[model samples]
Target: MDIIRIEQLEIFAYHGCNEEEKRDGQKFYVDANLYTDVMTPGLSDDLEDTVNYAKACKFINKFLTENRFDLIEAVAEQTTRALLKEFPKITKVDFTINKPNAPIKLPFGNVAVSVSREWHKAYLSIGSNIGDKEGYLNQAVDMLYDDENCKVGAISKFIQTKPYGPVEQDDFLNGCVEIETLYSPQELLKAVNAIEAAANRTREIHWGPRTLDVDIVLYDDEIVADSNLFIPHREMHKREFVLEPLVQIAPYAINPISKKTAEQLLDELRGQSENVNSGCAGCQGCAMRK
Candidate 1:
């Protein structure tokens, strides 16, 4: 990883809440550090392999001059997004917008806002047992792609699998998805839940049946233990239905601690039952893979 720092680039823009401030305009100072891997460019001495800071600065400057906003926060956010959009090499950014002359009469030094944003890798196990299963899955894929924050990376072929839990439910059609999203873990959870609800999925019976079932299987290299949700999905490894499809898309995704690949976990869980000893604390890969 490497850093490209742009320090205190001053610009005059008409972004403020107050009418007088908007009309009169004000000086805004922006500082940004673009984090990314520069090894490729450094090795080859090729501008194409890395972010060109000069070009990037020009983009940021032109963008602020063209777009109008009402807050420094908005300016910072928009600038960060614009920079990232222009340079795909950027991994994360720490951006700051400073307003040295706020309208208040008080003698405060300055008002500043800063935020960090990075791309997040997310894996989803999507399935539908009722209605047009493939259509439902494709529809979900389209919805995810339509979101600005979500970029569909890869998708595995749908697999026919016997239902888990009560076993009386219809045979499920399952598969895996790989995505790069700008949303946080909690935000992604809520978004997927919203998608599920929109598909008219019900929660009346546990594992009974559904129009669409989309589960968060992984998010980057994170491990979570929240009551509402868990990442590396609490049970994805042990369920052949989950592992089989996931392995197809990301066989090399290794568990952070256990260091097992999805393919290895699938091989281990071949003849096992889905619910047998699958718990969050003991999972070497997916919580379900314990």
Candidate 2:
């Protein structure tokens, strides 16, 4: 990735731990590496094709002066997020803040903190089996797009599917969405759960009916199997409801565990279903067997 470097941009801001430091304020130094493609602008000699360093510097200065925090870590984190949000073309940010006037009562050159953040690709499965099913699904999509940290990409058309569990509920409207997000897997899960709560989802039974259901299907080929979350969801390959809509939005997306594409999984599932209906011997080895 091409980078634009800004070194030691000094700013006077009110950020410190003590009452005197907070009240008096001090000068802070910032260094940033803005990652993006500069080849186009270089070749065409057009300022519009690349990030405007002057504007970014001005924004950085203004941001530091406006926000008050006790630690340099907060300054770096908040500044990087704001910079990424303001500059859509920049994919990543490497930020550092320097505090030379820290009150340690001893000789010290400087105290600093650095952080790096970037955007990641993630896929989600959404379903609604109760009232206003389609509307709930659409609203979920809108809410994801509304978040500044997330950029909605491709979305599949909704398809009706029978309930997965033993619950005697109505059919579900299922779909998939592709998005680019700056949030980690845990953070993304929290955001989606908040959206589900807004749609009045209830969790009375396992795999039971819901007003709105959101599951993380994939996240940049990452494999996470914890108590609360799992990526490339546990039962995605076996469920036609998930594979069908997932294939529409991301046909070539591979499952990290099985290393199979969405289309391949769907085809294998359908083939097994056919064999079961035809009373073939392979039914014993079918995905639906157990």
Candidate 3:
């Protein structure tokens, strides 16, 4: 990634722990490294092709002066998030705030705080079997798009599929969504859970049915396994509904654990299903058996 560097841009701000410091204010210097693709601008020689550093600088100055915080750490954190939001081309930010006149007894050259933040790519599997299945799925997509921390990307067309577990239920409309998110895995889980709750989903029976269901299928090729969540979705490879929709949007996305692409997994799953349906006596690993 190419970087646009902004070094030591001075601003007068009121951010400190002491009462006197907040009242009197202080001079703060901000340094930022904006990570983005500048090759388009380099080739096209157009200002619109890349992030406008001048405008970014103006925004930084205004935000620092306008916002009041007790810690320069907060300043760095908030500024980084703001920059990422304000400049869509900027995928990541490394920000620093220097407080030269910190109220310390010992003489120090400077006190500063730095933070680094970036967006993460995530895949979600969404489904609904209850009332207004398609409406519930659309609502979930709209909610994700409306979230400031998420930028919704390619979405697969919803497909109707039979329910997974033994508990008898109606057919489900399933789909997949790709998103660029600022939230970590845990936070992303919370966000999706909130969406499910808003759709009036209930956990009355395991794999029975629901108004909406959302699962974190994958996140930045990172593996996560815990009591509450599992990345690469524990059974994504075995489920045709999840893999079919996911392959539509992200056929090349690889399972971190198996290192197999979505397309490959889907093909293998279909082959297995064919074998089982054909009564292949040698096949011992059929999904139907389990």
Candidate 4:
């Protein structure tokens, strides 16, 4: 990844823990390094293809003057987030805010804070078995696209399947999504839940009928099991509904535990699962029902 460097832009702001530092204000030097695809701008010679350094500088200046903070770390963190929010093209950024005049008892050159952040690619599984099945599924896709931080990529055709557990309900429309997002796993989960809630999903029964159901299948090769969620979902392999749609977008995608591709898992599942396929194409009575 190429970098756009802004070395030591000087600014005088009132950001410090000391009374004098805030009252009289001090010279705070800021350095920002934006990370993204600079090759496009270099080849196309288009300003829009890259982040506008001049505008970024102005943004840093305006944000510092607008907000009041007590520490240089806070200033640096907020600045990084502001830059990312303002410029959609920036994938990652490293920024440092310098306080040259520290009121410490020792003579020092400067005290600064630096931090970095970036986006990650994630895959999600969505299913709905209740009212407006197709509607809930499509709406979830639309909502993911609406988010600025989320880049909704390839989506698979929805396939219908029987209910997974004891709950008796209508068939479900299930599929997978390839998403690029700037949110962490926890943050992304919140966003997906919001989308589900917008579809009027309720968690009344386990593996039950839901207006919309969304699960984070993979987050950049991470393995996690937390209080609210789990990655490489514990039960993905056993469900043909999840596997078929996943195979559509990513046939070679693997299960973190079994170390098998989605296609491989689907093949194994076809032999054991009760109802596998939803009847492919024109098959009058297909056995591969999910």
Candidate 5:
């Protein structure tokens, strides 16, 4: 990764908590470090392969001048998000906004807000066992696409698989989705849960049945274990329903816990299944395989 630094670009903007500061306006200093691959541009001397810092400076100035916010935190966050969205080559941004004229009685050099934001790769296991399973799955995908904070990447072919757990239920139409999202792990969870709720999913019975089920299978190379969510999904590797479709789209995607590829995980699960019951009659002819 290469860095493109824009240092101390000063602009006058009306952003402050105090009414006087907002009305009169104050000087705001912005510093940004854009992370991207600049090797090709450097070697080829092609402007197309790299970002134009001049244009970026102008954009920042124009944006800040046009937008008004009560807090510099908001300014920094909005600016970084806008920059990342506008420049496809920029992978990450380390941004800062300094307000030297903050309304404070005590003498202080400056008050600043610094933020870092980037797009994160994530994989999801989505399925539905009741009521237009395929339609429910497609609806989920569409919701993800419509979200401004998320970008849909590769989607695997859906496979019908027998349900797990003790609950008696119909087979599920299962598949995996690859996405690049700006939301953090928790925020992504909330977003997906909202989508599920919109589809009328219920949790009255544990693993019973639902109109839709979406689970975060992976998030970049992160290993997250919190009270609410777990990354690399606790039992993903053990389930053929998850690994099969996941391997189709992200075969080389590594599970941080086991450090094994999706393809390898699928193979290991199949091997274990073979050892337990070699060529089970139930699996001989399945619609999921088609």
Candidate 6:
């Protein structure tokens, strides 16, 4: 990653906690580091291949001047998000807002807030086994697409698969979704849970019928294991429904823990299923020929 630095770009903005400070705008200095690949521009010497610092500076100036916030922290956060969105080439940003005229009774040199933000690639597994199964899955996808912090990418074809777990249930419509999001793993979990709730998903019985089920299968090759959530989904490798559609869209996606690609995992799972008894305890769907 290459960095394009914007240092101490001064701007007068009305951003502060006090009313007087908002009324009498103060001078704010902004520093930003835009992270992107500059190799193409370096070799070609074409301005189009690189992020234009001039344009970026102007955008920062305009954004800061136009927006009114109560705190410099908000300024830094919003500015970082805006820069990432405005310049598609920049994948990450480190931003700082310096306020020298802060209303401190005692002498103070400066007050500043700095923030780092970047987009993360995440894979989500979506399924529905109840009424309006397809509708519920589509609604989940639409909810993710509607979120400004998330960019929905390739989606796998929906496939019907037998239910998992001991509880009897109807077949499920399962698929995977690829996305680039600004939310952290926990935040993304919250977002997906909200989407499921919107579809009237219930949790009465384990692996029982439900309107919608959204699971975070993978997030940027990250390994997360917590009480509430697990990345690479704890049982994804054993569940054909997850790997089947996941392979369709992200065949090369690697599991951080297993260090195996989606294709490799799926192949291994299928090979094991071939030798095992047809009647599997966990997921009968795997035993059924696709």
Return the lDDT, model 5, position 231: 97
Q: Which stretches of candidate 3 lie over 4 Å from their true place?
A: 281-290
The 10 consecutive residues of candidate 4 with the worst lDDT sum are: 274-283
Candidate 1 residues lying further than 4 Å off, grouped into runs, are 255-260, 271-290
Candidate 2 — which residues are off by over 4 angstroms? 281-290
lDDT minimum window of 10 residues, candidate 6? 278-287
When 1 and 4 are scored with TM-score, the better candidate is 1
- lDDT per prediction? 0.85, 0.93, 0.94, 0.85, 0.93, 0.92
Per-residue lDDT of model 3, residues 31-117, tens digit only: 999999989999999999999999999999999989999988889988888888889999999999999989999978999999999
Alpha carbon lDDT at 130, candidate 4: 76
For lDDT, candidate 1 versus 3, the one ahead is 3
TM-score of 3: 0.93
RMSD of each: 5.5, 3.2, 3.3, 6.1, 5.6, 4.8
Error of 2 at 123 (Å): 1.0
Write the residue-wise lDDT of candidate 2 on 1-290 in tens digits: 99999999999999988999889999999999999999999999999999999999999999999999988889998899999989988899999999999888999999999999888899999999999999999999999989998999999999999999777889999999999998899999999999999999999999888999999999998999889999979999889999999999899999999999999999999988888889885744664876
Query: Per-residue lDDT for 64-166 in model 6, tens only?
Result: 9999999788899888988888899999999999999899999889999999999999999999989999999899999998998999999999999999989
User: Which residue pairs show collisions in model 5?
Assistant: none
User: Which wins on lDDT, candidate 1 or candidate 2?
Assistant: 2
Task: Please estimate how well model 2 matches the true structure, expressed as its whole-model Cα lDDT.
Answer: 0.93
Q: Candidate 5's C-alpha lDDT?
A: 0.93
> What would the per-residue lDDT of candidate 5 be over residues 107-144, giving only the tens digit for each residue?
89998999999999999999999999999999999999
Q: Which one is best on lDDT?
A: 3
Report the poorest 10 consecutive residues by lDDT, candidate 2.
281-290
